[model samples]
Structures are given as structure tokens and as C-alpha cells.
Target chain A: MESIGIVNYWIVIALMMIALYIVISANNLIKKIIGLNIFQSSVFILYISIGKVGGGTAPILLKEPAVYSNPLPHVLILTAIVVGVATTALGLALIVRIRSAFGTIDDQDVQQDIERN
Target chain B: MIAIELVVNFTLLGFLLVTALYISQTNRLFRAVMLFGIYSLLTASLFVALDAVDVAFTEAAVGTCIATILMLSALSLTGSRKEVRFRRKNATFAVCVSIALGVALAIGIMDMPQFADPNAPANLHVAPYYLQDSYSEIGIPNVVTSVLASYRGYDTLGEVVVIFTAGIGVIALLTARTSKPKED
Candidate 1:
């Protein structure tokens, strides 16, 4: 309804699109993992931006100013980041196994090999 | 002062975009990994600007350190060079889908509250309660930690299990079937 004053969300959205495009378009599996990381990171940025208060400092309680950013999103994202790393590690391990088994890492070649087998 | 914040915000975002573009387009897998590391670092700074110090710390730790090292190890197993190019059809389809999704999300964002509005729905519901009562309830100064480990204990427990399962999965995938090993 009103003109947007904040541009952080839009920037995050753009990053999301870029990450998705990379995931869909990249041929290398490693590149795809990197894209997925970017996608997840953008989502974290979006959440953190939402939690921000106009004049808030970090959520650690101090005597100075009372304003503090939302702690919920930060906590949620902490779990998400740890899970993301675990997932990434698992994905890379799978990739290594694939390369060892097929003797090729290219998606097209791997597919062809599977079909032929 | 506000102008400086705005400038820093945009500049970090600009760097993010540039790094993403390079990562997507780079043919060298090693170079892309390096760029992705930089992207994570930039996002960490952005988190700090948003007063999400805890998120920034985790981002720096997990995104920069763990992800990059895992990727490089994977790269060492696979070849460093990407395939010649993506198929034209796949590239076109990816672009179309990304554009469509981006447009839909941008439109949805139009109704959302402006950045850092204290009265926004997210800030109003649940968050204020956490902030107000966290110290008394949990006897902890760090609201994030109190809420994460105390109020939301189940969620954190689930996360730990998920991480454990992932480690097991990696071990299963990488280990060999045969138990015998040659003497060194």
C-alpha cells in the first residue's frame, strides 16, 4: 500500500532467485551444492532482517538501551545453519561416491552410464 | 548516520549479488567455492548490521568454515573443471522459473512490514514475551540461548538428532563394504 522504505528484503529475494537459477542450471554437482548453500543463506538473511527492530542492539541483555532484536529467528536460524552444514557434508560424500563408482562427475555422463548399465 | 547505514547495507548486498553471479557463471569449481566463501562472509556482516550477532557468528562458523572445507574435499575427489556448458533448454527453463518465482515473491513482499518496524506482526507476537520474561524464566541474559535451549528444547533436540543422522549417513556412504585392509 505504501512505498517501501527498506530494501533488504528485495536484495534477499534477488539473491534467492540467483541461487535457484544456479541450482537448476549448473551442471556440476558441487556447483549445485554451493547454489543450495546460497539459497539457504538467503533465507537466513530474510529471517534475520525480519527480526530486526529499528533501534535495537543485539539481544544480549545490557543496561544501556532496552531495545533488542528478536531472538526467536536468530535461534531458529542457528539450528538451520548447523543442519545445513550436516546436509552439505552428506551431499558431498554422496558426490564422492558417485564419482568413484561411475568414474565421471558430469551429470549427463553419469546419466548415460546408468542408462547403458 | 542513517545514510551511512543505508550505504553499507546496499554495498554488502551489491557484493553478495556480484559474488553469486560469479559463483553461478564460473567454470572452475575451485574458484566458485572461493567465491561462495566470500558470499558467506558478506552475509555474516549483513547479519551483524541487522543486530543478529548470534546468527552472524554461526554463519561465520558453519558457512565459511565447514561448508567450504567439505566442498573442497568433495572437489578433490571429483574433477575441478565443470562441464563445457549447460544444455540450452535447461538454462532457459531455469531462467524462466527463477524469474517467475522472483516476481511472485516480490509481489507478496509488497504487503509486508518495512524493515525494523518494532510493531510489525512478527515483533509483536511471541517475540515480546520472550524478551520480557526470558531473564526471569530462564535466569539467563542471552535471550536467544534461553529460548533455544529452554523454551524450545524439543526443537533443539530434534536438530541434534538430525545432525547425528547426517554424520552416520556420510559414514555409511563413504565406507567400503569389505572389512579387510591391506597391511601398511
Candidate 2:
């Protein structure tokens, strides 16, 4: 039961490792971006998971008394999600430019092309 | 009830792990993007399970919808399918680094508070104050909205500026090629 209680954190860590693996192993620039997205999203989960209280409800007030989960993490993650969107958009835009410039999105090909140039 | 919760949590984690593995293994860019969208959707559901409705909403919107659309558009321009490479050394290095890092992280997590411990440091901090006073101070039902729009207004404004800057950067990058032809 103790392990079960902290299972959330363990899973979050596993997801992070998978994301890192994808980022490091994949050659496609877009795949790297996807891996990065996975990494960021998993971090988001980790933060939100830590903020949970055993019996907390969502952080919305009502007439009846209720336990609420931490609002701070939710607020922070909202800002992060927005920034993530912008960053991803910009990244994809840059990838488009890279494709146009090098004719391939593979890291090795692009590296060799740069060396030849 | 605890049993049910544990079951659901583990199931979601299992699905997330599988989806992530699929996304990494699929060399077809379009399939990978679709799987990433699925991953985001599952993550959003997990956020809901963790009682993060606002974060879940944002994840569904930005993580799944907007990010997927952006990646697909980029794929249209860049083309699908990854270039297969037989870089054994790089693969081995990446595997080693990822395993080392994963093990270190797992070991570190052993000291962390349980998933939903009410007495955890994170729950004992300013969060208690926010939960107690947000309604009276801001008169908003959603504590997250109040904090984001009022207490952290300046930060939100900065984020807006960031989005604006990114939009401008994307526009500039996309349009630069048109200007090159004219210059020639």
C-alpha cells in the first residue's frame, strides 16, 4: 500500500525517462520536439501530483465545506502550458525552416551537410 | 475505494507508458504525432484524476489540440518518416544515459512524500493560505483563476508577451523565404 500511494511519482519518473530516451535516441528533429513535449508534460504531471491532497477536491469554492487541492500548482501549470504552446509553435516553425535549408530533418544528415558546407 | 483508485491510477500510468513507447518507436512522423496527441489526452485525464481540473483543461487544449495542429503543419512542410540511421554507438550511449538518469530519479523519489499525503510539505506551504483566503479576497469560485489573473497578473502579462513574441518570430521565419526571391 505504501508503494501504491507513491505509485504516481514513480510513474511520473518513468515517463520522464522515456521522454529523455526519445529525445536522445531519435534523429528526426520533429521527433526530438515530440520527446521534449512529452518531457514537459510529464513534469507538469509530477508537479500536479505532488500538489494533491488525499481527499481534496478541485480548487473551486462552494457553499459547502470541502478540501481543495493546491491551487498554486494549477495556476503555475496554466502559465507553463501557455508558454509551452508558444515554445512548441516557435520550435515547429524553426523546424520547417531547417527542413527548407537542409532538405532533411535527420540530425546526422544535417550535421554532415553542415560539415561539407 | 483505495483499491479502485489504485487500480485506475496504475491503469492510466500503464497506458501512458505504452503510448510514450509507441511514439518513440514509430518512425512515421504522422503516426508519432497522433500518438503524442493520445499521450497528451491521457495525461490530461490523469491530471483530472489528481484533482487538477484547470491543468487538465489546459493540457487538453494546448497540449493536445494546439500542439498537435502545430506539429502536423510542421510535418506538412518538413515531410513524414524519419531517416533510419544505424548509429550503434549513439544508441548505446543514449540507452546508458537514460537508464542511469532513470535509476537516479527513482532513487530520489523514494524520499518524496506519498502521492496524496495531506501533511506533505507541498500541502502545508502557502497552498493552505491560498485555499483559505482566495474566495474571500478575490470573490472567485476558481482559486486558480483568481491566482493566475490577480495575484500573478504580472506573470500572466509576461506570458502574453512571450506568446506575442513567439507569434512574431514564427511569422518572420515563415515569410523570410518570400523576401529572398525578391532580393534576388
For model 1, residues A59-83, the per-residue Cα lDDT tens digits are 9988665998889899999999999
**Tens-place lDDT digits, model 2, residues A1-117:** 355667788888888988998899888889899999999998998899888877678989878999888889899999999999899999988888877777778888789888886
Model 1 lDDT on a 0 to 1 scale = 0.86
Task: Kindly list the per-residue Cα lDDT of model 1 for residues B1-184, writing each as its tens digit.
Answer: 5455556767898999999988878877889898988999999999888888888998998889889989988988676565446677888999999999899999989988888788889999999898888888889999999998999999999999999999999999899563332222
DockQ, per-model, please? 0.61, 0.64
Quote the positional error of residue A14 for candidate 2 in Å. Answer: 1.0
Candidate 2, clashing residue pairs?
A: none
lDDT of 2 by residue, B50-117 (tens): 78998999899989999999999998887765544545677678788889988999888888988888
Model 2 ranges with Cα > 4 A deviation: A1-3, B81-86, B178-184
Model 1 misplaced regions, further than 4 Å: A1-4, B81-84, B178-184
